[model samples]
Target: MLCVVYKSPNKEGAYLYLERRDDFRQVPTALLDTFGKPQLITVLNLAKREHLAQIDIHKLQAALKTQGFYLQLPPPPENLLAQHKASLQNDKG
Candidate 1:
């Protein structure tokens, strides 16, 4: 399926994917408020076989089918060393 994506003005790397271009009616008003204004990004074909940098294509398709929109939040920043130490402590505890 072809999906249209919009970038949020308020958040970096945050994107909203919709089933169609120029349609935000299915998006909740409260979410739109928090998302700020959306800037058009691109339209692409989404499929389980496709690869996306931050989002899973199958999950995006499921979300779009059920919710009419799919939200792609930025990937969480990693702290590998800190996480390793925390894991060691947990193992000891």
Candidate 2:
């Protein structure tokens, strides 16, 4: 299923990952403005690092508001494999 992933605009806006494509399509421009792009990037990195299936946008936003940072989800399995291959090559060098 396709999902809508976006950043919130409010102060320390958190990353939002909507399961429904419609929700993603419906994101208000004003909301995006409130959540700065940088903050959204941070959240995306976190979700990617942690390997989260579905992150709670509201919780992430709240954490960002209070802590200024959040844990990243782990990289996807494919990415992990690629990283491992790169590391092996580097070690050979």
* Residues 1-93, model 2: lDDT tens digits: 223355544443255554433233334566545545523232144344433455565565554555433333434446788899999999999
Worst 10 residues of 2 by lDDT: 38-47
Model 1: per-residue lDDT, tens digit, 14-65? 8999999989999999999999999999888775347788777788888999
Candidate 2's displacement at residue 50, Å, is: 15
Cand. 2 TM to true fold: 0.26
Query: Best candidate per lDDT, number?
Result: 1
Residue 84 alpha-carbon offset, candidate 1, angstroms: 8.3
Alpha-carbon local distance difference test for all models: 0.90, 0.47
